[model samples]
Target: MKVGLLFDARNPDGWRRPWARHYARILELCEESDLRGADGVWFTEHHLFADGYLPQPLTLAAAAAARTRRVRVGTAILQPALRLPAQLAEEAALVDLISGGRLELGLGAGYRLPEYALFGADLNRRFRQTEANIREVRRLWSDGGITPGPIQDPVPLWGGFYGPRGARLAGQLGIGLLHISRPMFEHYRQGLAEGGHAPQTARVGDLLPIILADDPEAAWPRVAPYLAHQMNSYRQAAVEGTDVPPPPLIRSDELRNRDPDGPWGMLDILTPEDAAKRIIEITQGLPVTQLIFWASVAGMPDDLVVRNIELVSEALPPLLQAAHPAHPAHGREREAGPPLAAEGGGRG
Candidate 1:
């Protein structure tokens, strides 16, 4: 399987650092991942947050592109709602050229009402806007008007949309998806078929919150707080501009419940071998071309996060790669677009 590391440079109140220092540290980690042979390095986006979530993923992607030579760089879910399609296309093109054709664009129709309000994007029409913007982006890429075309013939695209309608739209647009729901994935395939693309063309990639460590029981306490912070930030953003009362922050203790089939928020601290087995079982029949896990989740310490990236680069790939021999992805790994996944599968 293709392996990659993702960072959002989150600096929550308790863990806050100088923003410049944080970005530098994050780039250092991305460099570390690339040196360790990670398939890709990715960034996520957000805005108007107290914790200072990453607001400009393309800016960071460009930075990462400059920092790493071997690793693909990407935006996990850059909202196209905030920028004009031509602007988005041009920026992506520049990053693609900078990375030598290693940019994977994952777009989302944004759910945070506060961000939509700040960008003057209509929340109710965000999906349609995303679709329209994508069409315009394609036009810009193909037409002679765009000054510097992207290095890749067609830059790989993926959707961060999770629901059925959005998933179908993503498929119709011939973009890959970031999802884990099998049922929703079926909708994506149906959309692809409806769009005159083969159903076998459906692909997905997900950013798992899981941590890999030598000792699961021992590592749980150390990573749980950071995981909780990551989860709560997403939850808090969901209620940012809505009438619904924000839920209390997730406690580290609540991350317990290791039952394989239980209703646990289920973030496991696993050894490399166990992490491989879990990934294989979890994605047994899915078209998973990219598999990503958080790098330095919620400002996790460099030493600890570095070890995780090392295991990801060195330990996880062979284990997952071996498993893929028995359960292949029907040659989706050979396709040229979306250079994020490895020869087997790429990362987010």
Candidate 2:
């Protein structure tokens, strides 16, 4: 029942020149707002998307670790197959030390043909490569003697999956699972049980787009366009043979049997209340340990973003408490300490 925030670092306006300052402000706000209220902060990695800016999560997370003392830091997902596993292990350990052992590593095989093409990585072998990368990274962290071992013994490694194969792999590897939605959660649970790893206590977190408003109706116009844009982007990725499937939230009949064109043809009509209700219902059915909300998608105004966080904070507590009455509060004794120095250097 822990709550966290996820940001994609998207640049919907196609502007990159101001990315440094924009991201700095983003980190600052997250430190001041999200870190104080939530248990963790998460980011994602994407490339060449005129709509998004971040291509590196380790660097960004290292900054976050330095700025915040209490909140855990993580990557909602980094494409493990595209980079050297050893390098990732080193970076993850450094970030963990900087955060005083509050790093949640979520690794993924990666989708997006454009990213694969840009990196010259074979998309088809991504799953195998991800598995290999996870094995190597774990080895490096647990046994390989990198100077200054991780602050926490066996830093938690969460497998990011959008499908059954990756979910099964996570259970088999004895790592936590990161699910994107409710259906994904159900799929992962079945996958884990089938993998002969039933009753595993490994961590699981859900990623959902969340926005809260005084009146759900008044909030729709402000958030819907951005939601549509993201949906369309995923649809494009799916059409290009990336493993991402069309979002199940959108009904099949609405697309009129035609391929889901970006969000324009499919997403504009859905209301925020409907979206929130859908997500709530989905999470309730699944065995989710934590729920992470992507509150700031492209084109979502900063004011609305803050309001959404407030709404979610007020609304979700009851559900979370009911599901996990023993969930820990944010300002625990372990989390109270002076800010630590940024490991590997750079402003947090």
Candidate 3:
């Protein structure tokens, strides 16, 4: 599986940086990820967020493409239902062109009702609208609706939808899936057959919301606050404008072992060895093409974040694909010990 980085460009209050400076850092990190052997650089989208969450992922995507020589630059998800099909197609094509055919266009039916309202889009019809937009985008790229078309004949398209229903739609539409859980993977394959598409047409990836450190227990204190900010922000936005009670804001220490199956899922911290094992379990016996980890958590500082990227890009991949080495009673591999998930940060 390709090692990828996910950047949301979220700068929470109390940890904020100037917007231009923050963006520049992202491009620099994208360059670093590429030079350091990372395979893809992915960004996420959000709108009207208090932390100034990235609203235009494509803009950064183009910049990242230009900066990196080899990494594929893409969106973990761009909300298609909120944009005019033609305009979105044009922008995505430009990004692809800048990347020299290295764009993975992931589209999702976003859950943020406020984002829909901001664009005068109907939230209830988001899935159908997104499906139509996907068709329109394909036609635009292939049928000459777009000028000076994208470098790739059909830019690798993916559905960044959540849950079984969204997975099925991705299958019927015959696109790749960016799912987070094992159950969703099953649903996506099922949808592929239901839509008369070959199951082999399936390409899947997971947004593994994890942190890798040499010593996870030691890193928890430094990592928890930023992680908490990231999760709590998502939690609040999810229930915005709804009668449903918002989940309680997560605390830093509590994140050490919260419910993985709970609403605000666990933010796991793992050693490279343990992380590889967790990823294997997450994607084992599945067609997982990519595995992505967040580049930073709510604008986490580079000192703490960059090392993880280096480990993910370099140290981790080898362990994942290699045969198990015989370990001494006390060894680097032994440092990983039992799975971190047993503490509630992984698949339950």
Over all chains combined, what TM-score does candidate 3 have?
Answer: 0.90
In candidate 3, residue 126 scores what lDDT? Answer: 91
Clashing pairs in 2: 11-51, 232-262, 232-263
Better of 1 and 2 by lDDT: 1
lDDT of candidate 1 over 1-348, digit per residue (tens): 577888887888876777887788788778777777788899888999788888999999999999998788988889998889989999999999999999999899888899988888899999989999998998999994587999997899989988999889988999898876688898899889888888778888888757787777876777778778878888988998899999998788886745667532446677889988888887878888888887777876555676787777777877887777764422233212222222112111
Worst 10 residues of 2 by lDDT: 339-348
lDDT of each: 0.81, 0.67, 0.81
Better of 1 and 2 by TM-score: 1
Residue pairs in collision within model 1: 2-345, 290-346, 341-346, 342-345, 342-346
In order of TM-score, best first, we have: 1, 3, 2
Inter-residue clash pairs, candidate 3: none
Error of 3 at 140 (Å): 1.0
